[model samples]
Target chain A: MIVAEQKPLNEIKTMIADAERVLLVGCGTCVTVCFAGGTKEVDLLATSLRMSTKLDGNGKVVDEFTVQRQCEWEYNEPLKEKLDDYDLVVSLGCGVGVQTLNEQFPQKQFVPGLNTAFMGLPTEQGVWEERCAACGNCILDKTGGICPIARCAKQLLNGPCGGSQNGVCEIESDVPCAWQLIWERANDLGQIDRLMELQPAKDWRTSRDGGPRKIVREDLRLVAHEEE
Target chain B: MTTSTNGYKVGSNLERMIRSGEFVVTGELGPPQGHHAEEIREKAALLKGYVDAVNITDNQTAIVRMSSIAAGAIVVQEGLEPIIQMTCRDRNRLAIQSDLLGAAALGCQNLLCLSGDHQSFGNHPGAKNVHDIDSMQLVQMVKNLRDENIFECGDVIKEGGPRFLVGAAVNPFGDPFEWRPYRLAKKVAAGADFVQTQLIYDIPRFKEFMKRVVDMGLHEKVAILAGVGPLKSVGMAKYMRDKVPGMIVEDRYIDGMTDAITGIEPLPPLTKRRKALKAQLQELGEDDPARAEIEAELAELAPRIKEIQAERNKNWREKGIQMCIEQIQELREVEGVAGVHIMAIEWEAAVKPITEGAGLLPRPNVGSNGSG
Candidate 1:
């Protein structure tokens, strides 16, 4: 899931300083799971913005609204009615959600309330860790299902670089070297021999490093256009 | 992989050595942790005439030091080829490529691409890591710049790309042993012209890795320089083994140090000897000449003990030098091995002797051979 963190109060306040009214938009998907840009976050931020602006004597009218999934156009269709009621829309969601809101209402300007982090799952309560880089070429089968591209500090395809000491990365306190974990896991699974296969230099054409990525499912495309 | 025999666009003596097919010897130089320009010059001066190329480490262990480019430039001024080490721990892709260009402009032709130690290990624990690409990509990026005359972002270099004899780091002793060689093959496939592995203390495992490397015919594809360094002290050896990561230190090596001192019939430590002598003197009567005899013997034993410990210290130092000589000799016979990368860590003074003792002295004179 895509994770995000809400922008600091000062930055958000500065971004909406000139606006007289504001709308805080939240996502109900990945952001909620990561405790970043969920409904509760949106409410909390909206209240803070109102309080800050009120304290500053700006007298701005702040409002809160959330959609089931801000990335989908259907879930954001209701926002068309509330367009003229606010000067700016603050999206408390992933970057995709903010872009979606902007595309849904082309005339209104939207600002991101949160910074998108990565695509990962929560490893524990309130602790999220990245598991995939969306590199489009997955080698998890060879690495015993551990994603070095996402987890290793170096993103080394073949790693446990010299910096891995005592099964932990040199990066921080006990951040297990992803390659160390992969090595041990592969050893435990009795699939250590599979790692001997040389993984080629990854074709970056499928990754964001090459360009902005896109996905298309021909089978799911609209079969026919509506009557124009 | 297109093993480039077309010769380097900007060549160095190290490239010449690789081209000449003579066993090469390179040594690492970690610039001072602070910005003292003269320190690099001093190190480069000490190493200039003794090594084929001097590798200037880039903030090794993530502690910010004089930039490798700056240090390498200093080494260049000292009349030695410098292998400018670049790491992905701190820089993004843009900065990495830009820095490579700058390094090339400074006449750094040999490049050692590494995924540097994590920043948390440095003084700045809270700094965000910027591993925009791994060392594999860094190698590919160097190749891309040299071969394609373009950046990783596909931007053309108005002034031609930097030609580099690229090297990458490999670990032969790390777990899932069989994968070690395959990883080497991947680095070669990514355009690594040569490789220098992590500090190797486990000779048997390294020998096995070399055998696998030879079996795969990787030696024919790329030059492999085995890493060797002197263990200055027992504490140093223990720290590297018990604390340092990716280091393989067998118990026998540590036990060897303990055995050296323990082999002697151990004398009672000074405090114990003094207390025992005092009690014995009180039992005999305070004025006895025998008490003076015991005191004289106790005083004499201190000097003898000191001499024994001094001899033991010399033995350990010689033992360290001997260990390096044996490792290098074994590596010289290992099929698929090209040379040795002497990593003295902070012990730069040992490099000349290690190289000289290993019979790698009077550095080869393949000076800037620009031919294919």
Candidate 2:
């Protein structure tokens, strides 16, 4: 899931400071699961903004709304009815949600209230750790399901680079070394020899190095276009 | 020993010495932070005859310094063979290959491919690192460029490719300690002609690693040069032991460094005594007998303390060099060890004394014995 966290209160306040009326838009999708832009958070942010603005002598009308999924245009169609009522829309959803609101309602100004962190899940009760780099090509099978691209500080394929000491990365004492985990996992599976084989340089063409990516499912297209 | 039809691969002096079955020695020369070419020349002058080759580090520890190839060119001009260290942290494949070609054109005959120290450890922590290829793939890439006459992208080189005696680093002391030897074998399979290990202070652990490597018959596949460096002080020994990742500085070395400073007052005590005496003299009458006595003691103690400090500093360095020499001698006895890579970073002059003290002076000239 795409994990995101809300921007600082002061920074969010600055974003909507110029507008007389502000709507705090929350998403019910990934951000909601992560407790970032859920309906509850939107209500809290709206109340904080109302109180803070009142205290600063420039109290403005602050309202709150939640969409089922702000990333989809249809799910965000309900926001259309409430769009003109507010001068500014601050999205507490992931980056994708902010862009969707902008494209759906071009005339209304939209600003991000959350920073999209990474594609990950809550490892513990409240902590989240990144698990995927979305590098397009995956080599998790070779590395015993651990992703060095996302976990290792250097993204080293032929690792763990000399920095792995006592099962932790040199970057920090708490961060477990990815390659060390891979090695131990491989050892447990009796596939240690697999790591001995030289893993060649990764072809990064499928990754972001190839530029912004898009997937077109020709079979799933309802309206087929003529061939060029 | 492997040799090409015309000469050894790349015909480098380091390769020649290694191939000719002579115990070789390579020294390290760290480029200055500023563009001081003469600094490189002066350091190279210290290592010229004592070592088979000198390794010019590529912004080692992620600190910005003169480029390795540029410093290596200076070493070449100073009548020394240079093994230009190239790290993957700073360059992508395009820049790496381009720099190799440039390095070769500049008369750099050897290459040491490294996964550079993380940029976060350096001055420019904000700079983005470009580890487009790791060291293993880099070794293979260099081999492909030299042997197959092809670029990493499979484009044929119309003319000459960079012919280098390629090398890589290993950390026998690295974690998952059992896997370190196999890592070296991987490098060998990746086409590394020579290997220099991380600094070895724990000799027993290194011997265990080498035993495994020898058991695998990896010694026959690649020339392994043991990395050794002098510990400047007890603080340096402790830093290497506690702070440096993958480096295992035994407690004995720490004890040795500490012992070097034994019986030498740390100057603060002498200075404190002088301060008290001066205060006492100031409070007393101008012509007092005690004032003259205190003045005489102060005059003698100041110069004596300076000499003591100088003596202490010299003892620390001597102990450092002595320890390095002892390690070199011991490493020479290891079955799989090919040579010693003396990395006297910043203290280049120590290379001479370390080499000379180890009885590795009068380095073998393998120039004419390329086995054509």
Candidate 3:
């Protein structure tokens, strides 16, 4: 889950104050999960904007619409017909969705109404905590199912450092030491001996270190030109 | 004009005076589920001549609460003033306006506007939500009724309509506390005449909130009724702390409750009983190392014994009435507090004594401003 929070209402209003016709578009995927840019939120934003504009004597008309997934061309294609009716598009989607909307409608202006925070999940009601870094490599099997990359303050792979006091991280008292939790889980499973093993430094090339990466399969690819 | 007020009328000069901060007492009454006109009438009879007004909640939290309009009508028929709580969660502007008109025709003069709870939080998980408008829009719609005497679509029904004394809900202790005063001001600007906040446990924070309210000039514009709900038991205190969002239960209060009781211990047996026994045996066996070693074996047995004890106490019974009375007394003494919204959820029968102990009973006919 990608967590994002909506920008303040005043800031959103100022962004499209000069536009005559405003299109409020929301994505129903990552942003929706975070309670930032979703179908319900888009409707609310549209109504609030209309009310604010009316109160300010701007008298601008705002239209609201949401796509199933704004990060894909298939979802963006549905909005093509409605693009000409509005002067500006206010996207309530995540960063990827906003970029995709801008890319698809090159002739129209696109503005983001949410700040994409991190990949997280709803830990409980109304609370979203970051859980993954999408580092392209997962080491859950060795670390007792906890993602040290996201949970650890320094993302230490070997063991907890001296800064860990009484199983709590010194960096922030509220944040538990991930390595300490790993040790406790390991001890519970009677595999405490694994802590003595010296692991080698991790390779970073598969991650963002090698620049934007892509994967392709020969069986899934189509012949150039002939496929069209 | 009929001497007997049947349908809605403008709040009587007397009711308006009470709402204008004159010396008056206000209490809230939540109607029971199903047809219990007698039950409602009984509660109203208890509050008559004691409370200046009673607020009827509108399907609080999307639950199947009795209709506020019907409850308001019952309160009116009993000759008690009714404050109708209207929420936007279950109705659009058309329905809301019509309901407002119907409530007025029923002689309900006081209006409390709220943006009803999300349907997901209610018991009926599969119910559809109708948030056609937010609280602010609803407030504006009410103001529209006051100004143009027309609905949102510009259809005039009541040309010289009876006035509605509007109120709104504010939760200062909820998460994002900084937003409370601002939201209150927005509601005021949208035409809320008074504000009733969510239940407050921490009085110091409530004072700080009062200061903010003063700074924002909201205190001058709207009468704020402090909300107070007496803690019923230790288990309830813990539940509110962990389960309820935006509620902060003070440690001192919890500690006080734990210490007040005698013959009953507060600690879990595993940590308390075993540790005490181990310490006592250590003192006695300090001279002989082997004797001390023997005591260590018993230390291991302590945990098993403690577990059995814990299982036995799991079904132990306790009473909560005395604790609730103490909490009520403590809340009433908080400084800068104007009044309380006694929420005795399911314990409404105890409200009269709680209010009486707090010296909140015997409300005056007129408000502090002497304008009703």
Candidate 4:
């Protein structure tokens, strides 16, 4: 799941500083799971914005709403009508959600309320850590499921760097060395043979560096939306 | 051994010592985070006659500091060999290559290629990490530039390239302890002329790592320096044990200091007070009238305990240096161990005495051999 964090109250306030009427939209999917831009968060942000704007005598009217998933067109169709009632729309969603909303409602001004962090899960309550780089190509099978692309500081395909100390990364003690985790898991599975194989230079063309990527599933796509 | 290597000026004694099969002694200088050339010159001078070469650290621990190249040049002025440490932390390949050339032009012959400590570890936690390439590739690239006269992108160098006796670091106690040796092997294969490992207080683990290196014939390919440094104090020991990544400060070593200071027969006063407070809290069940008083006393006891430990640690400087000397002696017995890299961070004054006590004085004169 994509994890995001709400921007600082002051920063968010500045984004909507000149707006007299605003619609705050939250994503119920990834943002909700991480407690960033969920329905609850949207209400909280709306209440705070109202109080802060009132305190500043900004004369702003803030309205709040949440969609099932802001990244999907159908989930956001309901907001098309509500967006026209506000001078601006503040979206509390991951990067994908916010971008998708902007693309769908091109005429409506959308200010992001949350900073999309990364694609990861909550390791524990209130703590979400990045675990995947969405590199398009995955090597989890060879690495005992630990993604070096996301975990290792340098994302070296081979193994741990010299900075790894006592199962911890030299970067910080709180984080585990990704290669250490991979080696231990691989060792336990008796898969040292696979682990020993030096991963060749990755073709980064498959990653975001290659450019904007899109998925086309002929089998799943609706015939009406097929390319001309 | 008493000549130039790979067609470049030695400009340093450390490279000659490594080539001559003499156990090389090296130390690191964390260039002060300021612009005072005297500060660096003073630190370099302290290490001049004691160590074969001194490494000038590059923004170590990610804190901003004077450039290692600048400091290395200062060390050169002070008549000491400098190993300018370069990291892939803040620079892209272009910037990295440019700095390498600049350092070598300044007469720093030895270069320690490292994928520097992450920026989050330093003052600028929010800074972007520009590790355009890992240390392995950096080592390979430096080797290619020096040996093949080509850049990583295969551009031929019109001017002569750097002739660095490439160095890299290893962590014997890094995760999955077993892979530590293999990682060192990869470093050697990648063209590291020498390797200085992370500080090793766990003698058994270091011995195991060295044995593995010998078994793999890695020792013949590169000189392996076991990292060792002073603990300074019991608090420093505890900090390394608790905080430093990949550091292995043995329990026995910590216990040795504690036992030496005060016999283990009696519980520490703080521990006793803490236990007593816990007992009182449990009895009071959060509703007792005396709970507030106990809490207040508990807070007071903590600082008193710290004061006691600090007092004991006041005499730990000698103990720390003695332990370092002992570790060096122990390395002499370990096969495939070339020497030690003393990292006396901010404790530069101790190097002159520590090296003298370890019988490493009269530092080998490799400087002349590398000077063309």
Candidate 5:
């Protein structure tokens, strides 16, 4: 899941300081599960902005709206009519949602209220750790399901980079070395021979190095038959 | 010294020394953080007759410095062979190949391919690193360029290509101890000609690593240069022992360094004397005859303090060099050990004494015969 956190209140205030009517739009998808930009968070932020702005003697009307999924076009249909009522729309969604809303309503000005952190699932009750880099191509099968691209500090393919000790990374004792986990997993699966084989230089053209990525599934697209 | 017997690749002085079964000593020279060619020359001069080839580190510890190839060129000018260190952190394959051609064109014959320290550890932590290829792939790429005359993309060089005495690094003390020897084997398979290890402090573990290498017959495939460095001080030993990962600094050296300055205080005695004189003057009468004796003692404090501080530093440094010499001597007796790579970081002058103390001085004059 895409993980993110709400921006600090003061920074958000400065972003919409010039506006009179502010709409705090929340996404009910990834941000909702993560407790950041959900309906409850948006309500809290609206109340804080109302009270804080009133305290500063420059009180502006603040409102709240929640979208089922901010990333999808149709899920944001309820926002089209209401967006015109506000001078600035604050998106309590991931970066994609902010861009999506802007693209959907070209005349509207939207600003992000949360910082999109990474694609990860919560490892514990309140803590989350990144699990994937979305490096276009995946090599997890060979590494015993461990993603070195996301976890290793150096992103080393043939690593544990002379800095891993006692299964911990040199960067810190809190972060377990990815390669150590790979080694142990490989050992458990009796696939040590696979790791013994040298992994060649990675082809990064599939990654962000190839520029912003796009995918088109021909099978999923509907088209008219020109000949008919 | 025996000339290159036959088919010595690159034939660098360090390579030839290894091929001829002579225990070679290679020293490290970190380039200055600025454009100071004289710093390279000065460090090169200290390592000139002491080591076969000095490694010019590339942005060592991730702090930007003069380019290793540029520094290597300067070292070559100072009458010493240079092993140019290259890291994958800052360059893609294109830059790596371009720099390899540039380095080879500039009289650098030895190349130590490394996955550099992470940029987060350096001054530019905000910088984005380009680990386009790992060090293993780099080794294979350089090998293909040298032997097959092809680039990493499989294009024909069609002209002069970099002919490097390829090198890599291993950390025998790194975690998953069972996999360390296998990592060396992988480097050897990837076409590394010589391998230098991370600093060795725990000799028994290193012996275990070497036994595995010798058992697998890997000792015959590549020259294994054990990394050794002078301790410098008790603080450095403690830092490496407690902080630096993948490093194993035995407590014996820490205890030994502590013993070196057992009785001497690190602080100069003037501070001590100031306190003593203040108390003595406060306690004594102005007319007392014994006050003259205390004044005479204060007068002698200046030179005595200097002597004591100098003695403390000398003792610590002497112990550091002595310990390094002892490591070298013991490493030479190991079954599969080839030579020692002394990394006297920022202490270039210590390289001479460490090498000399280890009986590795008067480095063999291989002359220009076997140089590729």
Candidate 6:
């Protein structure tokens, strides 16, 4: 689950203030899951902009629409006809959706309405807690289910630091000590011995530290090019 | 020959009844879990004569619920005043304006503007949130309906233009309590006539909040309604304390419940413990200094425990009937408070007893004539 919060209304209004014909686009993907951009949100933002502009005497008009998924080309093609009618596209989707819309409609400018936060889950109703960092690596098998990259203050790969007080992270009151949680889970599984095994340092080649990365599955590649 | 009541011109007969200090019961009916209308109708009938109005919630928290406009129409058909809650979560300006018009045509006279909960909080985790406009903008939209009667579509309605009794929600207990008054002032400036607050638990803190409201001179511009919800059980109380932000559960309320469980009188145990601890500590103070320090610590614990116990007792006693009275009295005493919005959630039936016990008159039987 991608968790995100919408920017303040004044900021969003200012972003598209100059656009006479605005298209409020909501994504039905991660951003939608995070509630930053979705069909309902798109409608709401468009209505608010229209009302605000009318009150300001500019009489700016806004049209609202939501695509099934804004991150993919196939999902964005349907918006082609409507994209030309707008001076600017206010994307209520996530970072991916905003970029996808920008790529698809290069002629029309795209503005983001949501500040994409992190991959998380709804711990309960009306509460979304971040749980993963998408560090391009999976280490849950060794450290238990808790992800230190997201939960730990230091993102420590080793054991808890001196700052882990009473099984809680010192950085924040509600934040649980990730290393402590890992230790407890390991102890519960009768794997306390695993903690003694000093693992070597992690490689950063495949992660963000190594710059942009891509994966090409040879099995799924299409060989036929435009027969030239 | 109808005369003005309480300095308010009785433009409609209903306005006269509202001004007469009637019960003025208002209940919030959450949109159904799905598209079905049977359950919505059933709940609407329960409050038909009992409440002055029933508010239909929009996609609360960005989760898909039954449409507020549709639910509002249902309540109106059931011969009850329907207050439509519109949030800037799922719709932009155009849709919001259109929905407001639809609501007006369906006879929804009350409007509650809100910047809804984020989408991540809803059941559907993969939903987008639209906060293109905030609550202030929505308030302005309501003001437009009352003034120009023009929607975002640039079209003018020929008949039955909306005349909404606009309201907005506030969270006085939310973080940075200092900023709340300013935020509320902004809402008022945006054209809010009434303000409903989040559930209030600490009466003393709420009094302080009322003082701030008075100090700001907001008493004359807008009516304020204190929001209250009964603590059904100990588990519920704990949930509110541990999870819900902006809710402060007084320490005494928790201890009162603990005493009740042991079948011992709370006041006796609390007072006896405190007196005994204090006496032991005083005796120790004359003897060994270190022992006295330990005893002093113990004495401090006793007072804290007693304080918790007292609060618990107060909450237990006042939760059902006494709390309502206190809230009502608090509302009456406050310079700006005009009413109280009781959000009993599933305890809708208990609202009647609580409000009536508080000496509040029931809202006028507007539905008695069979027209909503």
Query: How does each model score on TM-score?
Result: 0.68, 0.92, 0.52, 0.81, 0.93, 0.52
Residue A180 accuracy (lDDT) in model 6: 71
DockQ (C-alpha based) per candidate is 0.25, 0.64, 0.02, 0.34, 0.70, 0.02
Candidate 1 docking class: acceptable
Stretches off by above 4 angstroms in model 5 are A224-228, B1-6, B265-307, B369-372
A1-228 per-residue lDDT for model 4 (tens digits): 988899999999999988899999998988898899999999999999999999988758999999999989999999987877898999998888889999999999888999988989888898888999999999998999999989998787778876676677777778888988898898899987686564644666688868999888877867747467
Q: Rate the local accuracy (lDDT) of all candidates.
A: 0.81, 0.90, 0.70, 0.83, 0.90, 0.70
What would the DockQ be for model 1?
Answer: 0.25
- Candidate 2, B1-372: lDDT as tens digits: 223536567788888899889998998999999997888888888888999999999998899999999999889889888899999999999999999989988888899999888888889989998889999999999999888889999998878567888899999998989889888988999999999999999999999999999999999999999999998988889999999887898998999988998888776789889889989988999778788789899999989888987988899999999999999999999999999999997898999899899999899877642321
DockQ of 2: 0.64
For residues B1-372, could you state the per-residue lDDT of candidate 3 as single tens digits? Answer: 122233323445334543445533466778877778987898887766656777788887567878999998999889888888887768866688888878877877788877665455567868765545556666667766765576666677555443577777877775335445655776777777667777666667777777788887777677677766555556666786665545666775565445444454444655565676667776674586566565676677676766654543332212233444455465445433445566666555556666566566665544222112
TM-score, candidate 2, is 0.92
| Local accuracy of candidate 5 as per-residue lDDT tens digits, B269-316 | 476775788699789998989888888887777667777778877998
Please give, for residues A41-70, the per-residue lDDT of candidate 2 as tens digits: 999999999999999999989999999999
DockQ of 5: 0.70
Candidate 3, residue A101: how far the Cα is off, in Å: 24
Model 4, span B1-372: residue lDDT tens: 123355433435766687777878899898888899999888887788888888899999899999999999989889888888998888878898988888877877888988887787799999988766778778888888787777777898877567787899998877677887777777777779889988889999889888898999999889888888887767788998888776778987686566556632233656887998989898886577888999999888877777766666655777788888898989878999888899898998888878888888877665475353
Lowest lDDT 10-residue stretch of candidate 6 chain B: B1-10
Superior by lDDT: candidate 1 or candidate 2: 2
Q: Name every residue pair that clashes in candidate 5.
A: none
* Candidate 2: stretches off by over 4 Å: B1-5, B266-308, B368-372
Q: Which stretches of candidate 4 lie over 4 Å from their true place?
A: A6-20, A32-61, A64-78, A103-107, A122-128, A136-142, A162-174, A188-228, B1-12, B255-314, B370-372
